[model samples]
Target: MDKVNRFIQFNDESVETRKLLLYERIAQALSNTPYMKVTERQLIEYQPKEATLAISVFWRHRTEEVTNLGRLSDIYLLSAGFYRQFDLTAWRTFTTDIKPHSYPKLARQLLMLLEEFRMMESIQKSRAGTQRAFKVRRDIYAEFHRDRLLSNAQRGFLADALINQLYLDIHIGMTSSPHDVFDRLPIDRVRQVAQRIFETETTSQSASLAFQIIALVEEFLTGDIVLPLYTFGEAFEDGKPMKQSSKAMESEEQGESDVKETIEEEFRTWHRETEEEKGMHLEFDLQHGTEGASDASDSKPGNEDAEVQSFGTGRSEGNEKEIGAQPEIEQQQDQSVEPTLQAGSDYGHAHTQVTFKVMEVANKTDTSSLSTLSAWRINHLPIVRALVTEMKKRLERKRQYKRENLTKGRLSSKLTTMLTDERPKPFYRKQAPSPELDAVFGLLVDGSASMIDKLAETKEAVVLFHDVLRELNVTHEIASYYEDTFEASKEQQPNFFEVMHSFDENRVDSGPAIMNFEAHEDNRDGFAIRWMANQLGNRPEHHKFLLVFSDGEPSAFGYDRNGIIDTAEAVWETEKRGISVVHLFLSSQQPTEDQRELFATMFGNKTASSDSVEEFASQTLRILRKLLAIAVQ
Candidate 1:
């Protein structure tokens, strides 16, 4: 029986990815700004200043259509209703002036609801199709608010009860209060002031009218509001409301600084684009030595072919020569290190603040080692042949179909044409041979000291992967990575990647290099995965896969605590760039619950743990088959 990963989830990542991208597109379209981004939050809100649309988590349990429509309603309110119609500056001024009210919270909630009512009226008038969605919204909110009003009124929470009643009054035209004891309240005065809400056009007018209703009902609204019945999208850029004196001082000090730095706006928030535009991307050439050197401050690096250096036990004399003949600045550095600002700045949580010097080790194994090749072939020949056969079958099936009804091509014979005297439109075309997967693969093997026991199984699995892909003539790269603990520091860490086989070199004799894999000092899984992903990003393939073979989690200098978060972020970033990452855990014993959870957090469901060499090999083949299936489809 084939070994299957028990923790494997059947949910398709591709579909979820596509759905997220589609939601972003929808937000962009609705907001009429390409910069709009959609994220999940506890309540629905749209920050126009930040160009972020947040959908509520409460819609998750609803049906797909209802949930989508609910999100659309929120976006429509914030985009069309408030963003374009409401006057934010005027609203701020009104709030600043009316700071000393008996029931400030109640007054704020009343203004928010009135403004929403105004925007909803405008939205329904302009977009007739949105009326149906709003009706559904009304039906859902009405049921909840009706029950809430009764509960709050019975408990003497008059402020909360009043807001709920007001929401139901305007939303569904329900006039009666839930209880008779609450009939002594000033309902007639509140209704009279609410009548002017439709005639008011701006937010300032809405606020002025809401305060009038608040003044009459101030006696009953003695307590603070527990929860708001409605939400107005976040309009204030500053988190807190500015005091009157601070607002005046800010107005007085506008543009007072002589030194002003301006940042160009972009439609998307990609840091890589900023680097390219600012010419911060560095290019170091290793092939022609110092002759191709670029000035760190002046040269616009051209697109040139330069081989990454090799280090560790696999390092060769040629590699040393390439590493030594660099401009003094480039000798010790294997990868580009970004310059950091000395002054403190808020770089945010997503920044890893780590740099790497990637050096690729050259393969030095002699092809004359027949014993190594014979040993691997003798033990894994059947599995290799089986994988190749199954892959070729899928590839052929994907390529063998034909287009039956073409306007111009070789003539086709049809009896119906003669019997019905139809126009002789009988042409067909053979479907062109589909490209082979249109994908590129990168295999990263961990060479940490902990892998000493599992090295043999890791090699066996890698050899099987190599033999099958080589037989199918697919493009791939295989490398082993480890971090040099002695050279690690706060500024930079040296990472060595030994390439057994690269995309350009698909030699059959490279199997000896695979057998020469060694256990090194430590593993920086995040840095290694990120560096490999950067390599794969440059390839011209639609589908990219990066498979990591490791024995445990990341363990390097000062990286133990935050290594999991960094690795997970790297995986998330790679997948966003259209790369699929899978992790294979090889150990002598089964993984514990904590170990399984750690791997899940880092790789999601794209991971498999194996305790034996045979199981590891089987899991590798299973993952490859699934990936190929996705590619062929």
Candidate 2:
């Protein structure tokens, strides 16, 4: 086999573009609107009915330079945690304006949003602490490739940032609404600027890397490319049984036809070339008038000296035309033989290397066998599944290894047997933790008039988080919002209401909250979120986090009776206590003055607002983690 023989054809331009698109789509799917499950983080694409939240809302990561599914997912989650970065207020204004038959609303909205985004971009630049942390975080992300898992602490770091910092003043300076975030900036124009900056930055790394990439792509498209060859899936197509008759028959005929012509042509060409080479060798010997000699003639037969024969063997000649003619003919023979030997050696070496490589691929049968490969080559559970699918694919690969070799090398029989053995090993079967229970801490929902819709999704989160937490045997307490003058002072950390935080110890907490709409405010910060954070803060060393299930406005918290300034003071006090808050915007439609105020006060820029309860959970959890990340370390 020659270097030319070890070639594989692939289309580059279309193929690379297709691959790049595939990668981009994967990013889209993972970062799509709505929420994906904790398990579905890497497996981002989903049918609408499969989830309660929009994929975009739930996904909390952004586009990355690399395309590793896992890394992209993390980055996606990171972005999803801060989904407000790419504000769609401009688009939102476009729609709202269309409804009103007014372009001014749209124009103002776009202008405001563009200003906000520009501010955000500037904020990103000015914030040295955030940039330093992000740089450190990028380094930690590289560790994830090696470790395959971000420690709880590392995840907490990201969550903490999202919860505490609004991604470095990207939303600072002027007050802005969702419609004002990205409205002003022309998307095409902005993209052009970004593209130019990137082009300038990337040009310095390698001037020809882009061109090399293009060249490699063109070679594939034109069918003028070659790749190293190795054996794979040989036992699959020929050895595996087909599940369906139609597929079996169709593939059977196709496989037979294709393999027959291909193998025949290939083998015939190889054999013809080989014979031609052998004949040439014999011809050169005869041309030198070297008659057939006994096997014992080259050196002492069956002796060490026989192996010592040099490259330029003296040609047999007698009574030549002249002395010069004899030496010249010998020189010609040397020239011819050396080049032939060189060509033969090159082919021979390649064949040997390829054979070994072919044998190196594993023959996996099922998930269990795939587990072993994952244990060796990977660390993520998601990657293990991909390997299993690829291993099970029934394709016929040429057996370039485990065959005859023209040269002899050391025989490491033990190693050969070890590698060739096909054994199954189960993966993703991580044993649950002992007792499998985390500590207990339940949420207090605001069952006020405005919070009714918000509670549905909040209740669902309670159930899900409870189920997972309970399985881990973590004890918890449940509480809900209800204001009363009967409770004590803000510094004293008064209870929301009488008996609002009680639940069956043996069961998961799902107790009803005591709503106090008639009481001071609507029970927002005055009692609900304020009281709950204080409660969680009291119990330390448990992964205790609070999900402030509210539209977050303090209007419901009776500012008239208790004074709005006091409510604001309570919010700051809660923050000082290290209680993380995840705001779940129940319904942005007809938002109360209170809801709008609360949404801005608590969530800042990355607020989670959804029309549907179910759809809200996926995004809520992502936001929860990001919010919690700030408090973790």
Candidate 3:
């Protein structure tokens, strides 16, 4: 049994993990079952038939028949699980009454396919998610069939039409057209007949209807007779029903019982042996070499004395090696500790602040020109909407806390007030101001010359982000920071930070300001982050987030080598003061090892990067979602 268990290998770890997660998502969709008990089921990748995608079976009988049906199989298994939760005794009886074996191979296959469609339709009526899963599976199958197996022939047309009709019937967004080959097939009529037959309220009527459909399809495919496949609701009359022998049934039961008992005995034996070994060790420890004296008569003569001497020699050698390696290990550990960033007196002289009035900045911005950039026109509205929805849900959850008030909630407070006469009138509980209502965001874009190529896409992302935040009514500030190339000197402040949008302005139309953003000079990331953090930290909002957009390493007049460390330290300090900082790396090229390490050091797990401009918005939203999840929790 153990050998057999070992031989039944599952799929790759990652593949199995994904399959399990998919199963969980589908199961959660069907959690509202009201009739038959729904037990949590495991999904194994197995092929019961050559064309079978997936099927459900008892856990104890799981097989290793592998299938390569991809995502379609996942949805099929999910749909099967959904249907299995309902009472299908009538459907099962109707199927069994047909005696599928009595029909031809094509008729049997058609029956099975029609049964699957019927079950799916029934499940879809109650479970909308099931309908979606069916549509996805149908689409996948359609693609595979059309691209690979479909041929321009009569049989191929029939097969394609059958699948196309199924897809059209289940998909809410799909419509029939004259261009479609399946348009000529009376799919609606076929569905109507199937539904009418299945819902006859009697097993005999339902079985008769199913047989009629099967015969009609058979006649359509093969020009032939119009006889029923089998007697409608009667058992097989021509052949004798086979029964299992009593002896065989008893032997099978005994075999299963024997296997169970054998497993139980093995566990007991292992446990008992473990206990005995522990007892022996305890006895030996208490004796402490006095075992020779206590059991002198039972001791083996010279061999026992030789074993003790050998054991002592081996222990001595092992102790010497351990003692010799200790210092080197300790030294290595000391060397591995990361050094902390230290601020020098000259650090404050590297960057100077630059502020601009909203009207002045807006006037200089060419919104129309910026909008014409190719990258700016990339459609990312879907991603923006999804992100906004996620953020709103988090905020809503935060605001839904129970609070104590004197208006309306529980009767207990009112009853207490009545009993104590604490107030002139009875007091009722009501919700108070939620602590999590306040949240502030800071958007910092690196205005270094290196970002010139990425500026268009970066601006687009910032604009979308600004729009989403404004829609959500979140307080946020957008700023661009760069060093002044003309003023850059060892003895003077060279860095300039430009404020495009401030929290106090509550501006929704910041598109002009975002468009005005242009690349200039070098970047002093640490100083800019520290300055941004200072502004965000002063806000009254409990949840403060500062997101930085940068291309690569920071390069300023005197802060190039130490800028990464400085930024990392600044991030740590900001987080220590209850401010969440995330870094978004926008680069058209793949990130180098050093680049990844620098960003990881500064942002930890709060960093996200996009190798292409198109993914910038999505990557930013992904990071935002993670940050919001932690902040809300």
Candidates 1 and 3, the one with greater lDDT: 1
Best by lDDT: 1
Which model is ahead, 1 or 2, in terms of lDDT?
1
Superposing every Cα of model 3 onto the true structure, what RMSD results?
23.2
- Least lDDT summed over 10 consecutive residues: which range in candidate 3? 44-53
- Candidate 1 off by > 4 Å: 1-21, 47-51, 60-66, 178-184, 229-377, 385-439, 443-459, 478-501, 508-613, 622-633
Clashing pairs in 1: 309-360, 310-360, 310-361
Cα-based TM-score, every candidate: 0.61, 0.26, 0.39
Tell me the lDDT of candidate 1: 0.68
Clashes of each: 3, 61, 0
Q: Give one digit per residue, the lDDT tens place, for model 3 in 362-410.
A: 4135546655533443566676677777766766665665445345456
**Candidate 2 local Cα displacement, residue 72, angstroms:** 47
Candidate rank order under lDDT: 1, 3, 2
Top TM-score prediction, candidate number: 1
Where model 2 places Cα greater than 4 Å from the true spot, the runs are 1-442, 452-458, 484-521, 556-558, 561-568, 588-598, 602-607, 624-633
Question: Compared with the true structure, what per-residue lDDT tens digits does model 1 show for residues 415-526?
Answer: 4764565655567777667656677899999888888877777777887888777876778899888877887776445566777888876545467778788888888777
Tell me how far the alpha carbon of residue 126 in candidate 1 is from the true structure, in angstroms, after superposition. 2.2
TM-score of 2: 0.26
